[model samples]
Target chain A: MREPTVRTQKIKKDTTRTRLIFFGILALILIICSVFCEYLTPYDPYLQDLKNAKAPPSLSHLFGTDRYGRDMLSRVIVGSKASIFSTLLLVGLVTVLGTMAGVFGGWHGKRIDTVLMRISDMFLAFPGLVFAMAVAGVLGGGLQNAIIALMAISWPKYARIARSETLVQKEAPYLKAARLSGSGTLKIVFKHILPNIIGPILVTSMLDIGTMMMELAGLSFLGLGAKPPTAEWGSRMSDARSLLSSAPWVTLSPGVAIFISVMIFNLLGDTIRDYADPKSRGR
Target chain B: MDQPALKVSHLTKVFTRKGQPDFTAVDHVSFSIQAGECAGLIGESGSGKTTVVNMITRLLDPTGGSIVLNGEDITRMRGKELRKVYARMQMVFQTPAESFDPRCTLGDGIGESLRNNGRSRRETRDEVARLMEVCGLSADFASRYPHQVSGGECQRAAIARALAIKPRLLICDEATSSLDVTIQKEIIALLNKLRREKDSDLSILFICHDIALVQQFCNRVLVLYKGKIVEQGEVDAVIRNPQDPYTRRLIDSIL
Candidate 1:
């Protein structure tokens, strides 16, 4: 019985490893495409052709043409730079900022912890998108403003995770040992605290990539994110929304692009989490 | 008169809660270890042995007391000053494996203090190897993580880490209690070797509930009961003729 169980566990481990590599490659490819999208597009995304407006999918234009006569495939390939990169940037910014704030608060718990945690609580209390809209509106709507808005609302979650993890690690004897070894506060936090607490934070950030992308697109759809002529996936979809019934391809093109990329990223995040967790490796 | 290596006067720790009265864990405990002396603090669980160790290591603030390490008053030290005092004193915790950062190798943990104190990388590496060897661990054990090593080996590594900076005072808070009987004897032997070799400089404050182990390792003994020192004297004297009821009970309970 034990032998069978061990064999099954080994099989499961192999499958997860294979899946991890598969999704990792797919995500990497998506990122690579977004980076070199300019060279990859067959047609200039911005160049309009009134003659081909609202044309259905064909061999020449695989995703059809929008009302502005922009090739849907070309537009999507170009839009990825803004859509994917901005989301990645937003996630990076929040992860760093939040983890810093959390570690600081957790390390020095007193008036500072109370104040910082309360501030995070205030951000968490608000509906995330609504707060982003309000912030974006106040900052004068643009992709940059929209990113700032999302960052302001998104960082609190990472902060919460990092803060809690830091709190748990704060009581570990190793920290005291480090302190006794003449390590200063910064050294202890960076060398001992951060490395131990980073696993959960990394997983959380990886999982947040897809959610953040969708939220960024949501902001663009609401006219708070990427503006017209920017070739952003959300704004492109928003621009073609009225053509849903007559020219469904126009609206569906960006939507499908968003769907495919989100699925890849989400699956990659799940695989990474599985890979990181030792217990999940079929123990 | 020479100052003791470690001296605590009227130490106390009160745990304050939201609606309940403050509970005192260590109540006005006082003790001192002369240079080169091995002083044992024996107490049952929740009898405030850990509280005293925590207070001495400055991991917990005493409600009312002063801690003097190496004849310098470190009771009010903070930040850089407190960190500087760590060079003179160090502690080994109950759980050997948990006393080290899980992410760091044993070598890193051992060399951490040396590097922090401005030693060159090459010097740190050489010193770590020497310390590992001195603590009965081979140089190859440096690359092994705490989880990969046996309890005795990890405890030895922990000892190596504590000894890296050559602290004048070593506080062992039930360091060997977590190990099995054979391993515990081995750790006690190691501590005994260190004490004999450094008899002129290093002082040890060995904390444990095992009266037999304390008698074997410690010269002086302080028996703690309900946050108070019920009795204290030479290890042999106290063991043979206990003064307080708690002390007698403690000695009787220890087989």
Candidate 2:
């Protein structure tokens, strides 16, 4: 214990607090903006005024207007609600489904582990976005279809992660002692294994929410997501791609919104991973 | 003669490898402890002592063997049956620091066995407090997590947890090896006190490489080498005359 430098390094990393409050603040603002967009805006996000169409960033309009004369700022703020809500739902579903599958697979190895893991491997074999696009295409166009497609492809990542983590967790000394104390598989998996791996799982979920947001936006851009007049950021940006030379704010505003939101989630993930680790305290 | 508390006969474990011959970790090992007796299984690292303990505790299913605890065969027990056998016999792990869940307080860790045994929450707390005292720990320390306490205190908590359901056989798998010399002696003293309490007929399968410690603690001793029981007898007799060369070496290496 005197010269175990590796142990010291690990402890230092676990306890170190990398100032993540900045990321938290950024994420919180996005959440607040999404949740309270209706009350915070001066203009209706969907009110298309052809007379003011393609207006540049102005004092009255703020982020100017899109091709349809809808306020870009208001649209970006309001459209986020759907993306955030869907991301939360997708994340929650993925975590529950994946962890349950993984815990079961890892606990009852042999045939069960092989079967569960192989199915996930099949899901993982496809390039994630391409597989999702294919599913969405087959299911026809709509936000609901796109979400279903995204969920179908996304779950395997969590399942694989949970399974591997559970395999390691089940071997921990406490769990073995729990077994020696007459605890059943359910008790050991939930009480012992799940708590230990929850930090990593949370980190995974947070980072992936950013990915899910981007995916939802991508589907929208391709006309297979939020229908017309919806004013989603990705579709909003796509509509302005042809008018790039004239009104850049139409595309740039939504692009910036997407970038900031995604960065906030990613940073939030790093902060959580650092803070949740017993060795790492936050700055 | 009184029936033995534990009977492990022809216990064997073979580690099969991919595209290679299997490694026999333990071969035809057999031993038994009489009720209220303290039996020490002495062996060096890789000598299959831990494997034997793992099999007996049912953590690792043996390749072939029968383990009978107080007249019940637990060798092939599965699911609910195996879980039932757990309360009757418990294993104290080598590393006390790792014996408890990091998320759980010492009180929760100790009270888990009682809860499994269907003791009410209030009753479990009372029993855990009493067990903590029996293991020489203060009641207030029960609220602390494993990492919050010292190694010696954690080991005492581990002992209390093992004894929570009042198991007849306690499989101590090099339990005191991870503690400091002072703490090691303290743990040994605690076990001795438990044995002398008269009402608790606790049988211990104490696994250790420390021949001198076994001589002080165990009534009977079994020496293992390369997965075989090379020598075994009454602890005093084996120490006074270690017939096997490996046993002599083990005794000589004792610091």
Report the lDDT of model 2 for residue A79.
79
Model 1 CA deviation exceeding 4 Å by range = A1-13
Q: lDDT tens digits, residues B1-255, model 2?
A: 377899999999999989999999999999999888999999989999999999998888899978989999989899889889888898888999899999999999999988987989999999999999999999998899998999999999999999998899998999999999999999999988888984448899999988888989999999999999999999988888989999888877864
lDDT by residue (A90-116, candidate 2, tens digit) is 788888888788878888899999998
Q: Can you tell me the CAPRI class of model 2?
A: medium
Candidate 2 pairs with clashing backbones: A14-A279, A14-A280, A15-A279, A15-A280, A15-A281, A16-A280, A16-A281, A17-A281, A17-A282, A17-A283
lDDT of 1 by residue, A123-154 (tens): 99999889999999899868999999999998
DockQ of each: 0.85, 0.65
